[model samples]
Target: MSPFVIAITLSAAVLHAVWNAIVKTAVDRTTTLGLVAFGHVLPATVMVLLLPLPNAESFFYILLSTVVHFGYFFMLGKAYQHGDLSVVYPIARGIVPALVSLWALILLGEVLPAQAWIGIAVIALGIQLSSWKVLRSGVGKAALGFAVGTGFCISIYSVVDGIGVRLSGNTLSYWAWGAFLHIFIAGFIGLRKRATLAALPLRVWALGIAGGLVSMTAYGLVLYAKNFAPLGAVSALRETSVIFAALIGLVFLREGNWKRRLGAAVLMAMGVALIGTSA
Candidate 1:
């Protein structure tokens, strides 16, 4: 990856971690997620009106990505319900890059060099290391299962959106449409939890929507980076967000065991350097 692409991806990682921290702090994960979806749709709706439409060929990929994203969100909510941010977040983010790389190799025929593979492994190991205490103590089976499911959904959508944006010929247009499609999720969740949705204070709504915007921008950066780099490598670099999330949890949420998490972050940073150099 070029330095420019690496910078963008790393920035996205920070933003991604920030938004997830917001969601993790919310009282109702599903309702907060719905608001986040609304946050995505609100801006996306305006952009869609102003931007050119994506090509017809890209629609199928866009739809596929949207469907996969729904699954991802649902699984994420379930994971959060059963585990702490530090525990669920690492496992969920940790598994995605490897899965994405495997999918890219098998389906997209994109084979990465040895150094890139080593970087991915190191990053994955660091992610696991950050969660070692939680894993050793046993994050409830339910959380582990849902988080693993979330990882699979993330990989599916990453590959789908990578191809989708390239086919659209206009990165912003594809991003806008993808964001707008989250409205379906927002609507569904809103309808299902009308009482909860309606009862949320304005402050909570603001936080949720802000979280949505951050999440949208984060993914948008990744989609743009995908245009210039291999999907697997880009995905692995993006998983550095796990390290960011750990730091956010420690500093902001006042979570414990900072020494181990910091060490994990250092290892992850080294892996990120390796991947950037290899690129």
Candidate 2:
């Protein structure tokens, strides 16, 4: 991959961690998640109006992605309810690089160099190391299940959008449409929490929507990167967010085990360097 694509993917990783931190800190994860979808809807609605529609060939992938996202948001909220951001986030993100690589190989006929595969393995190891404490202390079974499920959802969408955007012939249009479909997500959540949403403070609303904006931008960057790079490489790069999430968990959220998490972050960074140079 070019340095430009690597830069944007890495940037997206940071933003992705920040938004997840926002959700972790929310008073109501479900409502906050709903508002995050709403945030995506607001900008996507405007962009769709201004931009040309993505190709019809890509529409099926877009719809599939939207369905997948519903599961993703639901599982993510449940996982956070059951566990810490540091633990849940890494486990949830850890499995995606290999999963996406396998999917890309089967569905997209994409292959990576040996070095890239090694980088992926190292990143996966780092993710486990980052969450090693959970092994000793024992994360909730519910959290473990939900986090793994969330990782599956993320991998599916990443590949789906990777294929969709390439077929769309326009990254922004694909992104806008993909995000706009979250209206269903936001609307569903809104109706379910109509009373709670009404009672929420403006500050909560602002934060949730802001998180959504950050989420949108982060995915947008990833989508753009996908257009130029192989799906596996892009995914491995994007999952560097797991490391960032670990740091955020330690510093901002006051989660424990600084030494292990920091060491894992370093390993993940090295994996990132390997992928960057090899790609």
Candidate 3:
């Protein structure tokens, strides 16, 4: 990856974690997510009015992405329903890059270098270790297990979006439309739950909505960054959210053991080093 792309992805990592931290803080997760949906839609709705329509090809990818993104939001909400943010967030985001790499190679012939593979493995191992807990757990194991499955589906969507953006060849327009479509789908889900309006303090609304903007900024940067690097590399770097989310959970959420968090950091760092060297 080019320095510019690497920098962009790294910056997105920080931003993604920050907004997720905000979501994690919500007293009512569904309400906060509804506001987040509103935040993304309002901007994209404006963009849709100003921008030209996406070509037929872009539309197909965008449509597919919308489905995946909705699934991502659903799984994410369900993941929070099961366990600590520290445990749920990392496994969901952390394990994905490697899985994405595997899928890319099998389907699209996108291969990572051997070193990057090793790096990804190290990173995944570290994340799994950090998230593990003793048998006596407060949360439902079945729910957490399903949550993991949900997160895995999210990885599928990330891969889908990366490939879709590449095939569409107009990342800016694609993202603009994708944002609007994703919001609509999430809104449908939120309405079904009867949690479509803000029922929170003004501060929470402000933060959650602003978080939607931050999310766009982060994902938008990655869409542009994908132009320079292999999708696998770009995808893996984004998954660095695993480390960032872990730190946020520990410090802000007070979610887990210090030793495991340190281990997670070391693993993520080592993986980054390997991927960087491979690049």
Candidate 4:
């Protein structure tokens, strides 16, 4: 990948970690999640109105992605509920690089060089190492299970959007429509948590909406990069978000051992260097 795409994906990774940290901090995660979806809808609606529709061929991918997002949100909330941000975030995101690579190979016929595959493995190892304490203890089975499920959902949508945006012929339009369709996700969550959402304070609402904006921008960057890089390489690089999450967890959430994360960070940097050169 080009340096520009690398920079863009890394920026997205940071923003992604920021939003998930927001969710992990929220008192009412499910309701906060709904507002985050609302966040997507607010900007997406304006974009959809201003931009021409994405190709019809991309619509199916958009719809399917929306449905998959529902499961993703649910799994994420559950995972956070059952575990710490440090533990849950790493496990949930760490597995996605390999899975997306496999899916890209099978579904999209995209292949990577041996160096790229090795880089992905190194990144995955670094991510898992971020949560070594909890993994060794074998605690939070529910959190681990839900996090794995979330990773599976993420990989599916990553590949789906990778293909969708390529076919749409307009990256921004594809992103806008995909985000706008989150209206369904927002509405469903709102209906289920209507009482909680109604009682939320203004500060929480603002935070949720802000998190939504961050989330949208992060995914938009990833989708845009897909146009320039192979799906597996893009995803492996993006999963570096887990490292960002680890730092956020340690410094902000006060959740993990900085010593362990420092080692993981070094490994992640090495992995990034390998992948960067693979292009």
Candidate 5:
């Protein structure tokens, strides 16, 4: 992993954490997510007009990623319905890196360095530590199931998109097309919640659109980083967002047990240092 790729991935981590925090704190998560999907549509539509179409070979991966993302959104919405950000976010994001790495090695033939694997383990441990209280107290079976499902969806799409972009021969084009495909997801959600979606205030709409943009940019950075680094390593580095979300939950949402959460954040930071140095 080059420093440039690491920087891009870390930047994406911050943005990813911020947008997720927004959705976690929103009054209507599903509706907010729908609007965020709309946000993707706007930029994607524009980029599609400006850029050439992606290679034919990449279409299959793009379509597959879109389907996987639908499952991800569904699982994520359900998880949030039954769990707290501190608990749900960590579990949902924490499991992705290792799964992605394993899949990449088996399917994509991308092997990572030993230090990178250590960093991934450290980050995963830190993420679990951040949510130790909730896990110890016992989370609902539904939330746990949904969160794990969401993590699986994330891993699948991470590998899919990594290969898709690499095959596209034009990173921006693939990103644009991928963003454009979010319209199908937004449309499905919007049709299901037409009444509620229409009733939202301008401020809520603005927030959703803003979050959408942030989320798109965050993932776009990750996709770009994937072109330069091993998929699993990038995925692990991205999971640092869980720590950022924990801090955000503490400061903005006023969640309890700041001491433990801060300690967990420190652990994640150490993992990040290991990644940066090892790279």
Candidate 6:
């Protein structure tokens, strides 16, 4: 990958971690997520209004992604309610790349290096280790499981959107429509829970909006990176969010389950090193 694309991937990693931290720390994960979803629409809707719709062929795929992303947000909200960032974030974020690598091999004709496969496993195993305490702690384990499953759904949409946007040959247009639809769908669900959304404090709104914009920017940069790099590499690089998320948890939330956390960090570092070498 070029320095430029690598830069985008790393930048997206930061934004992704930051936004997730906001969600994890929310008073009500579901309501905060709803606001985030609702917030995302303003930008997405504006883009949809300004840009041409994706061609008919890719439109269905975009719709599919939108549906899956809803599940992602819902589950993520539930997960945050139950678990601390240290545990839930690793489970939700780390597991995706390995799945995505397998998906890329089957769907996109991308072959990852042997070393990267080991890296992927190390990353996953590290996360698995990190989660042991949470599993024993009895806080939102079910919610964490749901969030992890939802993250798998998120992985599917990301790969689909990545491929669909590329096939459309207009990256921004597809992203705008797909992203806008995602936000619109989530916002509608939240509006259905109007009381919860209305009660969100200004502080939450401020943080949520900031997080949303960061997330949107990250998505744009990652999609742009996908244009040039293998999906697997991009996927692995994006998982760097796990490292950042761990730090966020330790510093802000004080989720200092250190034995498990140190192991998780080691696994993430191994993954990053392996990926860097392969590049």
Residue 153 of model 1 has an lDDT of 97
Give the number of the best model, judged by TM-score: 2
lDDT of candidate 4 over 95-157, digit per residue (tens):
787788889999988876789778778877876786666578976778888989999999999
What 10-residue stretch in candidate 6 is worst by lDDT? 270-279
For each candidate, the alpha-carbon lDDT, in order, equals 0.87, 0.90, 0.73, 0.87, 0.85, 0.77
lDDT of 5 by residue, 61-174 (tens): 999999999999899888888876766777788778778878998997877678867877886787678667557877576888898999999999999999999999999999
Over 4 Å off, model 6: 134-140, 276-279
Scanning candidate 5 in windows of ten residues, the lowest lDDT window is: 270-279
lDDT of 1 by residue, 40-128 (tens): 99999999999999998999999999999999999999998987776677778777777887888898898877887687788778767
Per the 3 Å backbone cut-off, how many clashing residue pairs does candidate 1 have? 1
Residue range with the least summed lDDT across 10 consecutive positions in model 4:
268-277
* Model 5, CA-based lDDT: 0.85
Best by lDDT: 2
The model with the greater TM-score, 1 or 6, is: 1
lDDT of 2 by residue, 20-106 (tens): 999999979999999999999999999999999999999999999999999999999999998888878877887788789889999
- Score candidate 5 by TM-score against the native: 0.93
- What are the per-residue Cα lDDT tens digits for candidate 3 across 99-161? 777777887898778998899888777766755562255345654565567657766766677
lDDT tens readout by residue for model 6, 1-279: 888888889889889989899888877767667666666667887888888776777887788888888878877777777777777777777777777878888998888888988888788777768776656776566866875886698689778877877776677788787777756666666777788768777898777777777777888888888888877778778878878888888888888676678568668767855764575
lDDT of 3 at 157: 67
For every candidate structure, what is the RMSD over all alpha carbons to the true structure, in angstroms? Answer: 1.7, 1.5, 2.4, 1.7, 1.8, 2.1
